[model samples]
Structures are given as C-alpha cells and as structure tokens.
Target: MKNKLFLSLALFFCATNIMLSQNIEIKDDKVLVDGKEILKYEKINFFQHSFYSLTDDEEILMYKYNDNESREYKEDDYFILNFLTAKKKIECGDIQKVVTGLGMSSKKNMEKLITWLLKEKVIDVNGILNTNKLDTFYEKYNENITERTIR
Candidate 1:
C-alpha cells in the first residue's frame, strides 16, 4: 500500500509539471510560461522614433528603428505599419514573421507604422500612441501573440 501511494503521488507530480509547462499567461507587460517570465512587451519613444517591442531573456525581438529626418512616408514605413496594425485578422504565421524580422527598424518603417496609426486615427501626428487601440487589439488577439511567443 505504501509503494502504491508513493507511485501515485509521483505520477501526479509529473502530470502537473507537464501541464504547467504548457501554460502561458500574460499579465501587464510580461509574458509568463509555467509562471516563469519568458518575455516582456515594451514601448520606446525617442526624439526621432517611437515603437513597440518585445524582449526575450537575450535581445530585442520587436521592430526598433531610427529615422528622424524625413517627414514623408516611404515604402518601408508602409510595411512596418501594416505589420503592426490589426486591420485584418492577424494570423499566427504572420505574427511569427514579424517577431522574427529583427532590425526591421528603419526611419521608413517607423514612419509607416506611425502613418498607419495616424491614418486610422489610432495615434496623433505628435507621436503619441493611443493605448485604447492597443488595448482593444490585445483584447482581441493577445492569445495569438502569446502563443507565437512560446513558439
């Protein structure tokens, strides 16, 4: 009876560990896996650029770039803006690609991202990002973003 009880307890612990390992949670700006931090979401606004980013234990995974000179929209700006905007359904693969595209930072990309935000009235021309748009976006698709991060 003693041996059987010990074995059952061991199996129960193992099963709990396995289940916990697959659990992902987002609280505030952090993403937790099995209750341990795996990544964090951050926003940066400089004199020349402003953008959102994701950082892992090692390096930045979000698009970060600089371009303070031109006041015009370029091609790169359009691409960056399109990637971040949730105008259409954001698929898992699409997010994966964006996350992987490090150094996607450029003046153009920032411009485009900001431009889209401005166009959608998501943000203002003064470079202030409206959190409501982000909050809404996250509410709708945070699961997909968190899932992609784990992968």
Candidate 2:
C-alpha cells in the first residue's frame, strides 16, 4: 500500500510539471507555446461588475490538448494567474497592464484601437480574441510596436 501511494504521488508530480511547462508564456513581447510564437492575446473584461447592477464575465476559452475544440476556462493557467481571476475582471488602469503584458505597446491605447478595429469590423463587440483576424492584425502591426529579432 505504501509503495502504491509513493508511485501515485510521483506520477502526479510529473504529470503536473509537464502540464505547467506548456502554460502560456509571454517574453520579449511575444506569446510562446512550446517555444514557438503563438497568437497574441489579451485578458478581457466582459462587464463592469463594479456596482450592485454590473455583471462581469472574466472567463475565456483556449485550446485544449492541441485540439481545435475548447472548453470553458478550467484550470487554465492563463486565467488563473492574472488579476482577472478575481470575482470580476480588473478595472481602470490595471486593464492596461493586461494589454501591455500581451505585447501591446503601451503607447497605443487599446480602447481607441479596438474602436477603430470594430468600426472596420476587424473585430466584433465580443473583442478581438484568438481569431485569425487578430492574428493577421498582429502580423501586420506588431513590427511597429516590438522590435523584431532575426532568428
């Protein structure tokens, strides 16, 4: 019984480490997955949730196990570690932090850019999430904000 317990515990740690090693990492103004450049992302606030009447949706969906299908946020490290993990999405100046963290240039305010993108219909009211439009937008404009490194 003791040997079985020890083996089980060891397996658990190894499994957890493997899972965490694949968690999203942002470095040098790029989002990396398994050491490759992946789509840029932003933590979002779907509602105000500040007053008694405000409602906020802080959760997001991400790829599950390298498959196209995604479930709701569950043990997703991206959401779990950010302040958006709070009962409501972050507010005010802090929201900017999320944008900057996602490789957005601080010089460019998201509200104005997002408004223009929405006006152009590059993104919808739901926000410019993990879609190809966002990927293309980043591909086109990211060079202006972040210095490209020759590989």
Candidate 3:
C-alpha cells in the first residue's frame, strides 16, 4: 500500500510539471512560465536606432498575426499581446503589417501604434513605405502654413 501511494504521487507530480512547463501566462508587461517569471534584461537595438526594450529569455518572440486567434495568446491590437507581455516594442514594419490585416482594429489602436511609430521616427508623416517619394504639390499649396513665434 505504501509503495503504491508513493508511485501514484510521483506520477502526479511528473504530470503537473509537464503541464506547467507547457503553459506561459503572458500579461501586459510580464511573462510567466509555469507561474515563474523568466530572467530578462534591457536591450537597445543600435542598428535599428530604437530605445531600451525588454526581451524574453534568450528568445526573439515572433508572434503570428495570421488571424488564428485564441484566448491563450490573443492579439491585443497593433502590438502582439505576447511581445507586450515581454515588455518589448514592436517594429514599424510589424505594426504596419498587423494594422493592415483583415482583423477589426479599433480607432484608438491605430492611433496608438501610428503615434508610437511617428514618435520613434520609424515612419515619417507620409505613406506607408519610405521607398516611394511623396508628391509635395499638395503639401506646397494645400496645407495651411503660419508662423507663430513662441514667447
């Protein structure tokens, strides 16, 4: 009887460990794996000219925006919910791609991500891709220009 109880307990513990290891509960700015947060550090991508960002434990999280949404890892608007949980900023290209997707995104969502891109200097006040030159004829005549000296 003692041996059988011990064996059952061991099996239960092993099962629990396996289950826990397979689940990751990602919150807004924290990553929880098996109820324990992974070790993380700040990273400043100089090549891309980005500010300090948080990352996962030695892993670059590439979230899928293919629209196969699930409650476990749902899309929290423009930025990947998972990456936000890791406290990392999304690239402009990534944001644009997800933004243009068929998923129904809120106005505030578009404004937030677009505002972030503009703030980060990722995209200028123009079209999507920077490869094309914008025709400034409209801007040269259409836009109202005024000079007001600051006190």
Candidate 4:
C-alpha cells in the first residue's frame, strides 16, 4: 500500500510538471510553437475564472520574458514586420486594430511594427505615408484587408 501510494504521487507530480512545462514562447518579438515561428496573432481562450478585465481602474498583469541576451534591434524590426504582414494577411483587420486588440497598444509596439515593415522592404519608406495618414489608407483599403496574398 505504501509503495502504491508513492508511485501514484510520483506519477501525479510528473504529469503536473509536463503540463506546466508547456509555456507560451515569446522570442525574437515573435511567438513560437515547438521552435517554429508563429506569424499570426492567434486568439487564446481563457477560463472564466482566469479572465480578468483590464480597465483604467484595474491593474493588469503583464509578463515579459527576457532572454538576457542582447539582440540587434534592426533584426528584431525585420522579424516584427514579417510577423505583422503575415498576421495582417491571415486576419482581416487594420494592423493597429489587430495589435491593439492583442494587448500591444503602446507607442513602442506600433513603432516596432512599422520600423520592421520598413526595414524588411514590406513597405517602402519612399512611398510610405506618415502614421497620421494611415487612417485614411486604412479606410480606403479596408475592403481589401481580407485574407489575401501578402505581396
């Protein structure tokens, strides 16, 4: 009986460790699954008990996983743009709207995306409009924002 109880407890602990080891990866400003980069913004469903509203009066919990190694900001910029363009293609929404909805509403986030796009040649700087001009472009091209080829 003692041996059986110990085995059961060991199994339970092993199972718990395996479950907890499945952590969400945030690397190179991109999320990964099994080391493959995930390029689109994926919606996650939370349990009701785990869901907490974030309003002005409420403090929201944010997690940042730093790898403790310095990476070139330019390389990060390219990856970010590639990720955003891929996400934009997969999801029919303005980049800003999609990112903001995904809890990346800060100016820094926006800048990173924009800079990445420019660096990657996804959006030509010469023809690129200012941030203020993006609204009009968004409105005009909103209909074309559906899932399409990311050219």
Best of the candidates, TM-score? 1
Alpha-carbon TM-score of each model against the true structure: 0.29, 0.25, 0.22, 0.22
Q: Between candidates 2 and 3, which one is better according to lDDT? A: 2
For candidate 3, the 10 contiguous residues with the lowest summed lDDT are 43-52
Tens-place lDDT per residue, model 4, 57-146, is 121112122212334432211111112212221112234421334455343343344344333444333323234334433344344422
Off by over 4 Å in 1: 1-105, 139-143, 146-151
lDDT of 3 at 105: 39
lDDT of 4 at 103: 54
Give the better candidate number (1 or 2) by lDDT: 1
Ranking by lDDT: 1, 2, 3, 4
Report residue 108 deviation for candidate 4 (angstroms): 16
lDDT against true structure, model 4: 0.33
Model 1 agreement with the true structure over 1-151: per-residue lDDT tens digits: 9999999999999999877433444445454444654445344442222233333133222443323233473322211222343343222222332232446543334334333344454544333445676555445443343234432
Q: 136 in model 4: Cα distance from truth in Å? A: 34
**Predicted structure with the largest lDDT when compared to the true one:** 1
Location of the lowest summed lDDT over 10 successive residues in candidate 1: 74-83
By the lDDT metric, which is better: model 2 or model 4?
2
